[model samples]
Target: MTPLKSGTQFSFDLLAGALTGRDAARATGTLHVLGNPGGRIHLRDGGVICVESPGSPGPDALLLRTGRLSESEWTAALTTGTRGTIGETELHVVAMMATHDAAFTVVAGEVEDCVFTPQTLDTAVAMSVAIDPVRLLQETSRRITSLLALPCSLSPHRDRVAPVPGADLHDLAPVREEILAHATGRRTTRDIAFAAGRSVYPVTIEACRMVTDGLMTVVAGTSVIATAAQPLVPLRPRKPPTRRPPTQMPPTQMPPAENPLPEPPEGDDGDDVPLPRSLRRQLLPKLFKQPERKKL
Candidate 1:
């Protein structure tokens, strides 16, 4: 199949267009990417300070929806970024995480075109940070490469995934557990990411892995993947790794083995191999060579 021309490439081209050529590095404004899942990329000089997309949750959603920040607290923090308050540090990190996540979402889908509005990006809010455009684009490209390389090629923005019926589910991590619990046909991976308070790329990748493992499936009509008659490859259930049952040892076949864990260094007396350093020091201080007293 032909490669997607408008995914990350278009965003990179549009963004790069503003930063390249003669005297374009000083360009400052919001680049409005216009499309179904498009949003604004605010820049100053050459750095991207903010990226907002309807397709993906922003810092506000990352905080509010996840209960990480209350509306009052969010407002107070934004209003007062003083030290000892909610602080800009946490807000900065959240904004940065959301910016990258939103960028991936924007570039993962179709962007019709972008318009550069000649307006300076405002960083008065605690939730905005200056990000290098080159770095952002590189990260977006890397995310695209990783997402496409997955076994189930799915879009977080467009693919509304559903959990497989009566699928064997066991020992799921918190992320996957939340994904499984919240993945109705109505919610896209973007929605699930917002609901689960996670970055969308990993959520999308996990959904793809789940699809491949038969623990989940793309909603009947909501995926480019499902639109294809068959997936890139036939997906079958992947059994989670299981521990083998201890079998009765045959006297003829079995060899005597004492320790399952690593043995201590040879010639070391009163040493406990499995004990931690602190415990070992406490239990057997004499075994440790004392630092020789300096001659006074």
Candidate 2:
């Protein structure tokens, strides 16, 4: 088995930005290529878990060894040319692992140096196991395979920052330049938030939203941030239902309640009387008057 190498040294900010999926190749993060194909990748907290690539026979076997694809994903990719299609949710994490070679792609943010060769299902499985558990869960939910899709058409935009989808420029404009300035493949979300005098959650949410909108990109495994321009994917507008005529209702006066409460039992005790025998006994000693003691 061969260990993966770091692609580049990247900060959390750059990684976050790249993961946002608006840019391509920020070059700040390190990508370590394993000498062998189909290495296992391990991740934690949305980061790489680890990778293992055992040297063995056949290119297909090696592809399987990467551990990125499921049996079905592999079958689809080998048979159909496209297996794992990046959807809206997974793109943020998937785009972070983009590499020069189209045959290999990062899965679950961690498993590394995998090639989409046939007969390598075992390798792909192993690689997937190496990914971070949380990310793996997310990828699994989205049905992403470990194998790289052939003739990969998806590429990160270069250089310019694209607008985040559904994000208003007016609201973001106040911090826009600062975000761009600090996007230097350095700085963590905490650092950026502190510098911007905002909470980390809001910043992170905004950053992720922006990435989904193709306004930014992140380094593969680092926190470095960068800007990239992207073709805007238009959102489909929802149509409003046609209004219906209001139904006429006859006006009526409300009837007053005859009684707010039912009368107590005819032989009811005082309002303060205890409901249970045990409770009455407990209160009886305190409430009942003791026989007047005769003057000594």
Give the best candidate by lDDT: 1
TM-score quality measure for candidate 2: 0.19
Off-target runs (Cα >4 Å) in candidate 1 are: 1-12, 18-24, 65-68, 78-85, 121-129, 225-296
Report the Cα lDDT for residue 12, model 2.
Answer: 15
Residue-wise lDDT of candidate 2 within 1-296, one digit each (tens)?
00111221111112223332222222122233332132333233334423332311222232333454456775886666554753333432332222111112222123323222112122222122223322322232121111111111111111223343354445455555566456554554334544554433234334543555555555444422323322211112125545656785554543422222222332312122221222123222233333333455
lDDT for predicted candidate 2 compared with the true structure: 0.31
Cα-based RMSD of candidate 2: 27.5
Candidate 2 has its poorest 10 consecutive residues by lDDT at 1-10
TM-score of each: 0.67, 0.19
How much lDDT does candidate 1 score? Answer: 0.62
State, as a TM-score between 0 and 1, how close model 1 is to the true structure. 0.67
True-vs-predicted CA distance for residue 266, candidate 1, Å: 38
